[model samples]
Target: MIPVLWHLGNVVVDLVLDVPALPERGGDVLATRTEHTPGGGFNVMAAAARQGLAVTYAGAHGTGPFGDRARAALHTEGIGILLAPRTSGDTGFVVCLVDADGERTFVTSPGAEASLTPADLAELRPGAGDLVYITGYGLLHDSNRAALLGLLPRLDPAVTLVTDPGPLAGDIPTEALETLLTRSDWWSCNAREAALLTGLDDPAEAARALQSRLGRGAVLVRTGPDGCLLHHGGRLVAVPGFAVDAVDLNGAGDAHTGVFMAALARGADPVAAAHRANAGAALAVTASGPATAPDAAQLDAFLN
Candidate 1:
C-alpha cells in the first residue's frame, strides 16, 4: 500500500463538556459531564492508521500535559511521528461544549502547532505513489501560512496532494486557495465549505465548479447524513451515507477523509472507497470522542 503522509500540525487535547444548551451572554450553565480526548489532526491520522494504512504524521509536538497526552494517543494507535517537539510553547487545546443535540462549539488556545516552519516542510521527502494530506486550519494561521505556501512548490510532482479546506475554507487567502485548487489531486470538503468556496447552493453544482477548477482532478462534497457527491472523470455520482444513530458528530468528516484516502491507497475505486468511508464515518459518529474511528475489522463488520 502507498504511504499516506499527513501534514497534521493541529493535533490538540479536547476538553469536551456536555451542557444542556449554550449559555447566553453573561449567563453561566453547568456542564452535565466532561471527557478529555485527543482531537484535531489526530482524528484524521488515527482514522487512517486504524484502517491499517502506512500513515506518518509530519508535525510538531509541544511540551506539557496536552503534548504528553497527544503523543501517548498517537503511540496507542500505532501511528508514526516523523517530527519532534521543537517549540518552546505548550501544545494547543480546545474547550468543546456539546449541547443536548450533540452540536458542539469550540474555544481554542493555539500554541506550538501553529508555528510550522519552512524547514519542517523541506524535511518531508514525499515521492511517487505517496498521498499527502493537508487541511485548511494549517493555512489559517499567519505564522505557518508562508511556510505552507513555500512547501507547495517543493512537493514532488508525482505525489498526490489531497486537501480538505475545513470550515475555514472562506478565510484562506485567495491566492493560496487558488494554488491549492490547481495543485490538489483530490479536494474534499463539507457542503457549507463548498458553498463558501464556489458560491453555489447546490452541492452537485459546487462539485462541478470545483472539478472544473482542478482541470484534471476530482471533487468530493460531503453532505452530512445525506452522504457525499463526487465529481470525477467527467461524471457526477451521489454516494449515499449509512444510517446510524449518531452520538457525536464531531470528527465525522475527518474520519470520512481518512478512510477515503486509505481505501484509494489500497487500490479501491472511487465509489467503493466512498462506500467504505461512509461506513467508517457512520461508526465514528456512533462513538463519543473525536478520535473514535473504527478499525479494519469493525469497519468490515459494519459494512457487512
Candidate 2:
C-alpha cells in the first residue's frame, strides 16, 4: 500500500541567492544563482512524493506568480494540491541568501501564508493507514491552530500523526504544543527547536522533556552532523545521519521528516525507518533545492 501523506501548513516560494558573503545595507552582491522553489508545506509534500509516498497538500496561495509557481512545482512532483483562493495581497515569499558555509538568512513576507485560516481545514480528510503530517506554523496561529486541534478527535486510529514543529513550533504556547503532541504518534524536532520548546539547553534533555510532556508519544530530536535521538519511555535511540559534503542544508530536515513518516507508513520499525530517513536527508543536502530529495532507488543505492 502506498503511504498517503496529508500536509497542512503555509505555502511559499523560496527565492534563494548565493552570495559570496552576507549582503550589507546599500551594497550590491553578486549572486551565483537565483532560484525559486516551493517552500514550507509544499516542500515537505514534494519531498515525500519524491521518496515514493503518495502525497496530498492543502494550503493557501495567492493568485500571483508565486502561487502559480507553487502549483506548477507540486504538480511536477506528482503531488495533489488543494489551493486556497487568491487574495488581493501579495503571494507569500521568502528571500534567502546563502553564504559560503551554506548558512542561510531569510526575509519573509507572510502574505497569503498568514491568510490560511481555520475554515481551510475543511480540505483535509485522512483515511485509515494514512499518515498525517502537520506543519508547525499552522498550529501556531490561533485560527488555524484551533482548526487543527479540533480535527484531532476525527483522526483515524489506524492513521499515524507525525508533527514537524517547523522553525516556529517551539515559539507557540506550551498548552498549544501539548494539545498537538497529545494527538501525535511521533514528535520530530531539530536541536534548536528542542531547546526552544522545552527550555532545556541540552538537546537530549529537551527530547526527554518533550517526551514527558507528550505522555506516550515518541520524541525525535534531530542533531545535524551529530545525528538524531529518539526518546521514548526513558529510553533513547540514536540514529546518525550519513556523512556527505553538504552544499545546501535547505529542506534537509523536512526531507528527513517526510521519509521517516513514509517509512512508518510502510510498516518499518522506528529505528530502521529513522536510519532510512537519515539516508534520504543525507542525499538531500548534496543538492541545493527543496525538490533535491532523492527517490527510493537513490536512497537504496546510498544505503547500500
Evaluated with TM-score, which candidate comes out highest? 1
For model 2, residues 93-175, the per-residue Cα lDDT tens digits are 88878878877777777766666665677646788889887777776667767777777778887788888887776567677
For each candidate, how many residue pairs have backbone atoms clashing (under 3 Å)? 0, 0
For candidate 1, the per-residue lDDT at 162 reads: 89
Give each model a TM-score: 0.96, 0.92
Error (Å) of candidate 2 at residue 33 is 2.3
Q: What is the C-alpha local distance difference test score of candidate 1?
A: 0.85
| Native-referenced Cα lDDT, model 2 | 0.80
**Winning model by lDDT:** 1
Off by over 4 Å in 1: none
- How far is each candidate from the true structure, as Cα RMSD in Å? 1.4, 2.1
lDDT of each: 0.85, 0.80
Query: lDDT per residue, candidate 1, 1-34, as tens digits?
Result: 3566565548888999989999999999999989
